[model samples]
Target: MSEYKATYLVVGGGIAGVTCVESLAILHPEESLIILTASSLIKNVSNVSFYAKTIVKFDVHDTEATSLHKIHPNLNIVYDSLKHLDTTNKVAVTESGIQINYNLVCICTGGIPRLISDSRKCKRILGIRDTESVQEFQEKLKNGRKMVIVGNGGIASEIVHATRGIQKIWVIRDDYISATFVDPGAAEFLQDTLKSNIEKNDSPVLRRHIFSEEDTLVSLNKNLKSAALGPDWYRKLENTRNETGEQELEIIYKVEVESVIEREDTEFPLDVKLSNGKTVQCDFVISATGVEPAVSFTWDIEPKFGKDGGLAVNELQQTSIKDVFAAGDVACASWEHAPHWFQLRLWTQARQMGSMAAKAMHSKITNEEVLQDFCFELFTHCTNLFGYRVVLLGKYNGQGLDQNYEILLRMTRGHEYIKFVLKDGRLQGAILIGETDLEEMCENLILDQIDLTLFGDDILNPDIDIDDYFD
Candidate 1:
């Protein structure tokens, strides 16, 4: 067995792991570090443009792990899967039989999609997460006449919007569309766009920032991990080919997939039974239910887990185990969350958490104190839903506030939708759909804690330039 040593070691090559190693390399140039990943590529953030303190736009690129060697001479990249982590001895053993002794270790293993069906052995049922899953779905979609998408999150939202030509049936647990991101008003606006065939500006979809390898990654094992797809993963690849001129869209609300049964006598091989006592035969099932932290490798170390099945981490991103830290989707913040800030598994948080975790690790080693990042002050999300720019700020859904908040809304069919959540006459959260150009001002208002009792409903008036009012 070969043995190696590094002053710092990180597992997983997703945005979190890559950002952590890059930050450490910059902060401690004299120290040597290693990045261990199961995948052949590492996620890199490029073309970043910050609109506010925490709200930013960026693109993700999948780069070859070997090419990262040029960034820092001391940064070593190991292409191996972690099998066991010994927190007491500070040793990590990989599937390749390499034991790595590390001074400090950060777990950035990301997450694995929670499968809806127990029969993962079946090729007909699929879960979307990495490029491999998308490819598998694409191959199946070629001859697929019908597909049942189960879930009401970003993944399912994008899939329904991107996939045309197929008879798409969505199984949403919530009554409204994109319920994870928007409320009913915004959902209605998006739903209207989804039903209308008014051609979207396909030009913007062409301006993608994805980079992939010619040779796909070989699965290391059954538990091989990969980074979740970032924003516009669907826009980059549009598979719109249907034999029928009119695409059929159906929504089964407030229900879930009860069971998926395979049948041999039908043209469609699968029959999906719903909780609402309905069974539909479809070509395949797309399970975007959600994800669980990829922390199975840490069973030996036994890091404290949160209710969400993620490794419980302090504000410093340190796990319960000494000298072990976790970031990205794998780490769930155990500290009391800031009023405006709540955790949502997104690319933005992954990058931020990874960078902050590096600083926390460095400060611990140097005996220095570091303040919590301002990014944690408020939750800001920017993404596209139904070909519309969607921005969510602070308590977008009035989460944790109970019935104490008030809402103000303004919507124009086929144009824009805006909603503001106010508590005690202060802007607590806001959702801006379409090119509202109000995200910056809304974010600032929420951050400044300015009272807007006098403005009332006028805050959303189209004639009033909200940016000028804030300035």
Candidate 2:
């Protein structure tokens, strides 16, 4: 590749990286920018967000209480790989071995699929690594096919639900899925709901609760959350403890991907392997893998660690490197309110981090005379599950809720409403699995950041006036 130069260097081309460049161009249009990716820009993975999801719905609105629907927008992406970097002279080289100079650099190389093992036996899934691969995989699903997506996180389950009318599917979870987010009963609530639906449909389906390498990570420390004092039920549940629950009970081995392969009698087939030593034969395979911050540029600049040699920054998004800014998935987040400082990695956090970093970068322009917190606001998220639209805000640890909290249960005429709130009244987090209108109420409650302390603590009693908050 021919050598190029830029005043600002933005690596990777995912949502975070793209947002980073857009922010920079908005802030420093006069500065030359370099966005380097290793492959075709358009084909690189991007995030498939429930937040960005669109749908068609007729609207009758004058002004207030307007209806919102899907609005599709054309997106453009570009990519070129980086091969070298010289932090001292602030010059970098690309994979094509082309050299370029920069004034400021932002490393957002995104993440690689953190598959526990590199075995080709298991069907590779798109967790958080790439968005394009997932879109392609979804396209393959639209072409009429069956697939077995392994893993139990929100991503896998979301994919399972999205492909519902289209693809015949089986989702295997060693233990409970998303045990981290929902409580045991809640996870069980979800597991039972999905499993029963899958069984009722009689689509070729299987769920395993036997064992997994992920279970081994049950004790490992998360970057953001620090380990708290007492024991947590979800942790044990995630570890697959002996519990009185009907979990498809299929003891299929992750290594048993070979066994399922023979079951796929289809003439057009996509081979799939699992970490459990099992083999699956499907028309396609998708792993809902994850991504990490890209910090290859920072590695050589200073002291580094296991991966993403990123310099630590406070909440303001300031890095160890002066005037050098970082944001989104690229910024290493510290735990704020809890037993531990768990690493914060999510879409909302990334975007918030990016925007905050942009603000800080601008602050450098005359800048602040006083020493600020050097902080970036962390994020929380809301999502949809099949017919159920779920919203999770703030940090949700595996531990059960404190006694001061109340579970608001409401069945209005027929709509079921269940909302959880902290004793202090802030909306720690909420889930809306049913009652579509309740999501609106919940979103409003969260958005307004109201205090429920004045109201009765018995939210599950279903008599509280939620309209007041919205009003």
Candidate 3:
């Protein structure tokens, strides 16, 4: 068995883990740092741009782990999966029998897709998470004519938009699409955009190299779970559109999958039965139904866990165990959250948490005081949906407000949609869809909690330049 020692150790190669290591490398360039990951590829955040105060936009690149060594000479990337964590002794054992002793450790193992119950019994059911799984899905999609997607999150929405020339059945338990991100009004505003077959250039600037044969072999032989796909992951997929330009789509709302039936005599390989007593035959089922925290390694003493099965961490990103911390989807915020801020398992939050965790760890080592990051003061996220730029700020959908908030809406049919949540005449949240370019103003309003009752409904009037008025 090989023995290694590091002043700082990080687990996982996703955005959170990589960000944490990068921050640590900058903070302690002379100290020995190690990153243990299952896959040889690591997610790197580049070309970062910040909008307003907290909304961040960045390009995610999957690069070879060896590349990081060149950038940070003090850092080492180990291709191994964590098997055990002895918190008492400050030791970690890998599946390859390599043991590492570390002064501080940060776990950012990320999450795995939460597939439907019948996924284990059926070969036609698939969950898209990592690069390997995405490749498998693309290959399978090439031969598939009809597919059923079960989920209402970003993954499902991306898949629905990226696929063409094939029949699609989108099954959701909510009445509206994208319930995870937007309210019903926003969803309705996007209905036409979703139905339009007009293709738009939605590809992001990808700064990654082509996979080599060695990379393929390593991916195939990997025993530990691969890291979750990062932002705009679907854009990398090869569209399996045939020569026919005709596209077919059907959406079944307010229903859940009751069971999956396989038949040898049917033309379609599987039949999906819904809770509404309807059955749909499809070539395969794609489960984009969210994810559960991936905590594969066992510890001498388990850390506190949240309801979502994630390691519960306080404002400083410290777990219950000493000298151990967690971030990303694997870490749930257990501290007193800001009134408008909440936890969501998104790439933006992952990066924020990762950087914050590194700061906390450094503070602990230096015996310095550290405060929670300001990014957690108000939730902010930006993404593209159906070729439209969507910006969500604070309590965008009036989450946790319990009907005490008033809504102000402005819609221009196909052009733009804006919605605001106000409580006690104070701006609480806002959602701007399309090229509204109001993210900066809205973010300021939410953070300032300015009273807008005087403005009344004229706040969203298109003729008035609210930015200047507010100024």
Each prediction's whole-model lDDT (CA): 0.80, 0.44, 0.83
Residue-level lDDT of model 1, residues 244-351, one tens digit each, is 435478999989888999999998999999999999999999988777898767446577888788889988899898999999989888989988988877888888
Model 2 ranges with Cα > 4 A deviation = 1-5, 39-79, 116-131, 135-146, 164-175, 184-284, 294-299, 303-311, 335-343, 369-378, 397-417, 424-427, 433-454, 457-463, 469-471
Candidate 3, overall lDDT?
A: 0.83
- Scanning candidate 1 in windows of ten residues, the lowest lDDT window is 204-213
RMSD (Å) of each candidate, 1 decimal:
8.4, 11.3, 9.5
Top of the candidates by lDDT: 3
Q: Report model 3's TM-score to 2 decimal places.
A: 0.92
Sort all candidates by TM-score, best to worst.
3, 1, 2
Candidate 2 local lDDT, 1-471, one digit each (tens): 556666666666544555566666676565566666564441111233333111111111111100100110111222456666677777767655677777766665555554434334534333324434444554555554455565445565555544443334444443445533443334444545445444332321111121121334221224322111011111111212214332322323223233334334666465565655555555655554345445554235662233343446565566665545565565665324332113446544454455555555655653654232222221234444433545554333322333334334332211223435443565554544454344445444544567866665444434445555455
* Candidate 3 lDDT tens digits, 1-471: 899999899999999999999898887788889999999998899888887779888878889988888758978788999999999999999999999999999999999888987999998999988777888899877888899999887778778877877789999987788777777777887776665553454322211122222332111111112124566788877864646544478999989998998989999989999999999999999988888899988999988998778899999899999999999989988999999898888888899999999999888888899899999999898887766778889877666664456777887667778888788788888888888888888988989888888987778877778899766
lDDT agreement of model 2 with the native: 0.44
